[model samples]
Target: MSKVLYIKANAKPEGESKTFRIADKFMEAYKKHHPQDEIVTLDLYKEDIHFLTVEDVMVHMSNEVEEKENPMKRYALQFKSADKYIFAEPMWNLGIPAILKAYIDYVSIPNITFKYSENGPIGLCQGKKALNITTSGGDYTEGMAAEWDLCDKYLKTIMGLFGIFDYTTIRASNLDVIGMDVEAIVNKAIEEAEELAKTF
Candidate 1:
């Protein structure tokens, strides 16, 4: 069966986070379509995915010499096991959260997730897809605020390093602070997510 890795980057549990609610709706729709598919949810807030340090980089690079397996190795394995990936995060400081970035640092290793070649760095994890579900308090669709969207671009670039080019983004920007209809905006994001889940 196809496997999907859902990474929840929000620290808030349930009612406090609007991003979590949107992610839950997207996952529900995905489950309805692919009931038999395996779903692995990685809650970043709960997990202790430490930021990459110099020691960690050394361990990754000297794996052959050290010949010892570690937690980072396990993380890399888990990342390779997924056929599809889903990121649920809120836009923070025009970018993703620190936890998600930490996870990415752990997974993006040379000769594992990707490799350097003469042509360029080639992604080893091919034939995989990804979906990024994000919410922001600021309006960033197609206006003066569009250029400030760093979340989508960062996620896309990181996923592309693993050869995951087939991707979709579900964004609900200006949800809380827009002074507009919040329910309608959220429902619209849900509708978009449902449609995207069908294609996935």
Candidate 2:
């Protein structure tokens, strides 16, 4: 069975978060479709992920730091071993949450998730797939506002850096837009998530 890492980046709890609501449907459908697959949920807020410090960077740069001795190695190891990834978050100030970014940094270690090459940095974690489920108050998928969207764009770019090219994003947008039917929009995203989970 495959290993799926479900990374929850929102500060809000599962019940209050719209992003989680959609992800919940996806998880339910995904479980139904892939019962044998192991799903591991990493809740960023609850995990209290911290930003990398100077010592952390030094440890990563030094080959002398053993995997077991490094405080942050577990995150990278967990991330590297996963066959699939699910990122669920809400758009905050046109980007992702601070904890989520910190968690990404924690797992993006050289030689573990990537390595240096003569040409450039080559990702070590290949043959992996990722799905990004995000919610935004404003619509960022089209028109001029799309330029302000850094959440999905950044995640896709980072995933590619890790050699995960088969990345998909399911965005729930315009939920807070005035005069729009919020429930309808969310329900539509939930349906999309459910369908995608069937084949994901």
Candidate 3:
């Protein structure tokens, strides 16, 4: 059975957050489809994820530090070990949450997720797949507003650096738009998510 890492980067709880509403349904469907697979959930809000400090940098750079003793290495190892990844978050100010960025910093270590070579940086975690579930108050799918969608683009780019090219995104947009049927939009995305989970 493959190990799947489900990372939650939203501050809002279930039922209230649009991102969670869709992601939770996807997780439920995914579990039914892959009963034997192991799914590990990492809740960023509940976890003690912090910004990378000088000590964190030193731990990885120093040859004297034991791999087991390095706290940051644990995150990198966990990320490298996962066969699949699911990221759930809501777009905030055209980007992802700061805590989520912090989580990425911990997992993205040279020689772990990637390594620099003569051809420049090369990703180590090849053959891994990723699914990103995102929600935005304003529509970021098309038209002029699409340029402002930094959240999805950023995630895809970063994941690519880790050699995960098989990436998919399920987005629920325009939830806060006035006079729109918010429930219908979200429900539709949830339905799509459920279907994707079957083959994901």
Candidate 4:
């Protein structure tokens, strides 16, 4: 059976946040289409992920030369265990939360999740897909706001390292602003996410 890993980065749970709601809708549709698939969820908000220290980086670097195991190897194993990935986070400071970034740093190890070649970097975690679901207080579509979207770009690049090129994004923006219908926008995003989950 196919395995999907849902990584929830939002600090709030359930009705407390809109990003969680969107993720729920997408997962529901995905499960409906692939009932036999196995689902794994990594709730980063609840997990204590530490930032990579200088010692950690040195250990990884030494492992590359000596071909030895590093302490951060478990993070890479967790990332490779899934056939698909889903990141549920809110756009914070034009990017993702610190915990999600820390998690990526821990997992994105060379020769484990990826490798360097003469031509370019080659991904080790192949045949996987990803879906990114985010919510923002300001509208990021078109001319509504500045296009400084770091969350999407960062997630895409990280997933690319694992060869997860087939991906989709569901966004709900302008929640804190007035003159926009919040319910309508959220419902539309949910509907679109449900449709996208079918093919995922």
Better of 1 and 2 by lDDT: 2
User: What TM-score should be assigned to candidate 2?
Assistant: 0.96
Candidate 3 residue runs with Cα over 4 Å from true position? 60-66
10 residues in a row with least lDDT, candidate 2: 62-71
Question: lDDT per prediction?
Answer: 0.85, 0.90, 0.90, 0.83
Considering every candidate listed, which one attains the maximal TM-score?
2
For residue 88, give model 3's deviation from the true position in Å. Answer: 0.3
lDDT for 91 in candidate 4 is 91
Per-residue lDDT of 77-99 in model 2, one digit per residue for the tens? 88999999999999999999989
Better of 3 and 4 by lDDT: 3
RMSD of 4: 2.5
**Model 1 poorest 10 in a row by lDDT:** 62-71
Residue pairs whose backbone atoms clash in candidate 3: none
**Clashes found in each candidate (C-alpha, N, C closer than 3 A):** 0, 0, 0, 0
Question: For residues 125-166, what per-residue lDDT tens digits would candidate 3 score against the true structure?
Answer: 999999999999899989888888999999999999999999
Query: 1-30, model 4: which lDDT tens digit per residue?
Result: 888889998778779889988899999999
